[model samples]
Target: MSEENLRAAADAVLSRLVGDAGGTARLRVDQWRAVEALVVERRRTLVVQRTGWGKSAVYFVATALLRERGSGPTVIVSPLLALMRNQIDAAERAGIRARTINSANPEEWEAVRLEVASGEVDVLLVSPERLNNPDFRDGVLPELAATTGLLVVDEAHCISDWGHDFRPDYRRLRTMLADLPPGVPVLATTATANARVTADVAEQLGTGGDTPDALVLRGPLERESLSLGVLRLPDAAHRLAWLDGHLNELPGSGIVYTLTVAAAEEVAAFLRQRGHAVAAYTGRTENADREAAEADLLDNRVKALVATSALGMGFDKPDLGFVVHLGSPSSPIAYYQQVGRAGRGVEHADVLLLPGPEDEAIWRYFASLAFPAEEQVRRTLEVLAASDRPLSLPALEPLVELRRSRLETMLKVLDVDGAVRRVRGGWVATGAPWSYDRERYDWVARQREAEQRAMKEYAATAECRMEFLRRQLDDEGAAPCGRCDNCAGPRFTPEVDPAALEAARGELGRPGVEVEPRRMWPTGLPSVGLELKGRIPPGEQAAPGRALGRLSDIGWGNRLRPLLEQGAPDGRVPDDVADAVVAVLADWAKGPGGWASGRPEAPARPVGVVTVASRTRPLLVRSLGERIAAVGRIPLLGTVEYSDDAVDARVPRSNSAQRLRALHGALTVPGTLAEAIAGGGPVLLVDDFTETGWTLAVAARLLRRAGAEAVMPLVLAVRG
Candidate 1:
């Protein structure tokens, strides 16, 4: 096809896509160029344009033109469910038949597969995760790769490990790209990527020699519609207060992003109390609820959705009016991607960042969960290589010390490296030599630390906020937008309503979080030298307990985190924290589930207190237990002592099996304490913090075996 013919075809598709909004919308010069590369030249292309710049339009238009030319369906590898939903709706507007194969639509996969096979579907969207699915990768993907007309990788930054939101599953795309037949145009798109990430993704796109090189379309990264600002709040309570006072004044419906799921829920509940129509959207939220929340936000029924990063990427609401961050994200690129969600279609949108002191602590917590040690990686490969058949994740769990999530992440990287393969039943070794790229991993870690520093700079910089963000992305055209807080001078006031502040303080200060005792033992505990499996006997199990707050909660978490963090000097519990614990105990007595509520199902009130001896924070734990026992006027039963070897044992931080193995024989009830608790009512077990709950479980079992009727565990905080 000639260039003129391709341009005309793209313009026609654009008209259908817009549907009389402006009476036959036409593609911009860049959009037309992208479409031309995909349809006319049939060459690979990478488009890095700002949000709302018709990136999706380029692909949909190309798909229409190619299908008209008797080409096969386009396969779009999308990243998020919300993104997939938006794309499917957009495809229909362009008169393209589109279907999705994602976790949410399992029931429709067969029909969608048939539609694609029969040439009835014009486009199909699949998540990067679906690319690694045993059935899809082994069966459907091969066929789709051979016949796909145009392959689209949305959110292409994810393809590079150095990208802000790197996803391991996306690395599988390299193989897919390598396997594509000649003349199949490939298009990768992202609104956020630095020079390094862009180059990495571009190199991947040019693989297999189908397209020796890719046409890179890089646009200026500036959102003129956004008026960005940062407000350094004193604490979480003040941040909530500011939102309660100012949310309605913002332009329209928007998003209130949080760093953690607990924060999202806490903010949502507080906003509801403040009479705002809002909902929490996080990875922990049910799919149906997420769908409903997205709809409510779309229809302007809710003022905002309090959300975590789960709400990031691919969610399309062109006129979203505002975005407020309760805590700063660790990377400027990630921050830019999230703030991009707003002001896409609207002429103006408010973007505010409320950075708290706890942000760095949260960043450090996440950093600890990064790629495992080289020894651990080698052990995983050895286990896989020794197995004759594919081993499922559960089966592999017993043989490796890594947690499920971290384990899966390692497997994905291995699969991408050709060291392992995901097969019918599970995963198997590929008998390929693989070496841990220590230097590359170290470089990635340094990049992450640099991004963290960049984020801090973003919050404190006096320059134009947009310019600062663009510079982080290595945008050559970065310049002051002359519309941000620094350039335009304080677009928003820092003053908050006094009543709202008090309410927020009250809500956050009144803390009592339920700590549900672990019931079922972690699977494969016996394989790690712990002779335990299945359910904990009812008699030996601890009753539902209470904690002052979660380490992830936006409320008391800020106060408790520092006190309980690793390497903190061990000392007596603070008076204020002791008082807070007393308050929690008072509430527990009168609460619906309390023992003193006189419900038949409730356990008896504690007749004594037993403290779990802590090797690290002995003073803190013992002081807390003594205070509780003294306040309740109950006998102070002696502590459950750790054996000499267990006291100095190095416990694994990765998996439940290792944690259980370390705690199996660690705690032993002293003979004196055993006699003290004999024939007693429920005992209150005190600890400074609960990480895996294994320590509490082991201590409770020992107490129960020593004749306590019941054990109720109480801790200062529960780690997320």
Candidate 2:
């Protein structure tokens, strides 16, 4: 087809996609070029366009044109459920039949598969995770690969580790790309990928010796409708207060993004108390709730949805009038992707960032969960190589020390590297010698740190915020937008209402978070000779406890995180924190879910206190225990002694299995302390922080075996 014919077909498809509005919906030159590349040239292409630039139109129009020519269905590998939903709706608008297979609609997968096999579906959307599903990969994927007319990878930046939101599952697309029959044009689109990420993804899209080169379409990353600003607040209180005061002033229903789930919940709750109809949307939120929240935001029924990064990518609310970030993201690319959610359709949308002091702390916490050390990787491979049969994640939990999530992530990476294969039952070692790419991993880590530094600079930069973001995406055309805070002066005031500030302070400052006791031991604990399984014995289990705050909470978390951080100098508990703990205890005595709230099964008041010996923060732990003991008028029975050898050989707090192995038989109760607590009322177990809760669990079990009536954990902070 000639360029003119391809352009004409794309315009027609755009017309159908937008219905009556489609008449005037002519394709941009870039859009037409992308369509031409995919449909006419039948080439692999990467469209690095900004959000709301009609990247979807490129794929949808190409799909329509390809299907019109009797090609098989366009298979779109989307990242988020929200994105898939939006794509399906858009496809329908273009008069194209669309179907999806994801975790949410498992029951409909069979029907959707049948539709695809029967050529009744014009486009099919599947999440990157779906590509690795044993059944789907073995049974449905091969057929799809053989017949797919066009392959579309939306949010394709996820395919590159250098991308801000790189996903291990997205790497599985390489196999599908390799398996596709000849002449299947591919399209990879992302609104956020730097030059490095683009090159990486483009290289992955290349078919080595077999496929033609991918046409890379890099465009300007700028959003004119967004008026960006950064408001460095004094604390979480001020941030919340600012939102509470200014939320009503924003043009339309929008989103408030937080860095953590707890912050989202807290902000949503505070907003609700302020009479704003807002909902919390986070990874922890139920799917039904998330769907309802999305609907409420779409219909303008809710003021905003306070959310974490989970609310990002593919959420479509064209007229969303504002986007407020309660905390800064780690990277400018990620920040752009999130703020891009706003001002996409409207002429103007408020985009503000109220960066918190704890943002870096949150970033570091996430950084700790990155890829494991080479030794750890080798250990995993060795364990897998020793196994005779495929081992499920749960079954491999004991054999490997990595947590389930991290383990699965490693396996996915290994699968992509040809070191392992995920079969029908579980994962199997492929017997392939895999070298640990230390340089690559190290470079990635360094890049992450650089990104973090760049984000900090972004918050403090005097240059145009939009330009800074654009430059981060490696947009050479980036320039001062002349509409941002730095370019045009502050669009929002730093002043917050005193009354609102106090209210926010009170709400956020109020302490006490429930610490649910671990019920069952981690799966496969028996394989390590721990002999623990099933539900924890009622008598041996610690009662549901209370912490001063969660480490992820915007309010108390800010105050407590620094003290409990890994390398922070250990000292006696701070006076302010001690007071907060006292408040928590008082609330625990009288609050709705408190033990003294007339609950039938609530444990009785503690008669003794036992401190868990902390190798890193002994003074902090001891002081906390002594303070609690004094406040409760209970005896400081004794401390759980950590064996000296055990302290010297302490294992890194990596995963459940490792923690359990390290803690097992590492804590011993003194005979005198055991007798003192033999018939006492419930005992208070004190610790500085609870990461995996394994330490507390081990302490509780030992105390119970030593004849304590019950154990109740009280800690400064709980890790989310």
CA lDDT of every candidate: 0.90, 0.89
Worst 10 residues of 2 by lDDT: 644-653
Count the clashes in each prediction: 0, 0
RMSD of 1: 1.3
Give the per-residue lDDT digits (tens) of candidate 2, residues 125-203. Answer: 9999999999999999999999999999999999999888889999999999999888899999999999999999999
> Cα miss at 250, model 2 (Å)?
1.3
Alpha-carbon runs more than 4 Å astray in model 2 = 1-6, 592-602, 644-650
**Cα error of candidate 2 at position 166, Å:** 0.9
lDDT of 1: 0.90
> Residue 73 deviation, candidate 2, in Å?
0.5
